[model samples]
Target: MLEIVLMHPDGKLQRLEAPVGVSLMQVATGAGVRSIVAECGGSAMCATCHVYVDPAWAGKLAPPLANELEMLECTSSERRPTSRLSCQIKLRADLDGLTVQLPESQQ
Candidate 1:
């Protein structure tokens, strides 16, 4: 299993363990992390699962694909350099302990 951290705007932290091959959105939604609405599920068709990857770990992830980048533009919160759609981030062993921040809102 891989460990991932989700930091909420209020400074609360949610730690989750998930197997490889699933998207971050799956882990978050499955774990009941309120910030990851995932309106389109894990299809990368919506920005409700948007997250700001911890800058320290951002470089560890692959660059967002074209579709993900386009969907990111529709996020309700301000987009940042580390902004990403959790649905697009596939879990891997190398990503254990990865951390991301939830925005103030998803609507």
Candidate 2:
């Protein structure tokens, strides 16, 4: 299991314990994390599951694919160097302590 720390826009953090191979969206949505709407589920079709990976853990994740990169343009938050679609982030042992900050809105 990996501990994924989700930082809400209001500054609260929800420490989630999830198994490897599941996408971040499924985990967050299943956990009922308020910030992640997951409008397109884990399909990478919507950017509602956007999050900013903690700089400390950012490089550990794979780069976004073309589809995810295209969807990011529609996110409510400005896509920063750390911006990533949660749907594309698969949990793994290497990401045991991953931390992501939710955007102010996912509309």
Pick the lDDT winner.
Answer: 1
TM-score of each: 0.97, 0.96
TM-score of 1: 0.97
Compared with the true structure, the alpha-carbon lDDT of candidate 2 equals: 0.91
Q: Write one digit per residue (lDDT tens) for candidate 1, span 1-107.
A: 98999899999988999999999999999988888999987888989999999999999998999999999999999999999999999998999999999999998
Error of 1 at 81 (Å): 0.3
In model 2, the runs with Cα more than 4 Å from the true position are none
Q: What would the per-residue lDDT of candidate 2 be over residues 1-107, giving only the tens digit for each residue?
A: 88999988888988988999999888999998878999887898889999999999999999999999999889987889899999999888899989999999898
By TM-score, who's the top model here?
Answer: 1
Ten contiguous residues with the weakest lDDT in model 1: 39-48
Instruction: Please give the lDDT score at residue 23 for candidate 1.
Output: 94
Give every collision pair in model 1. none
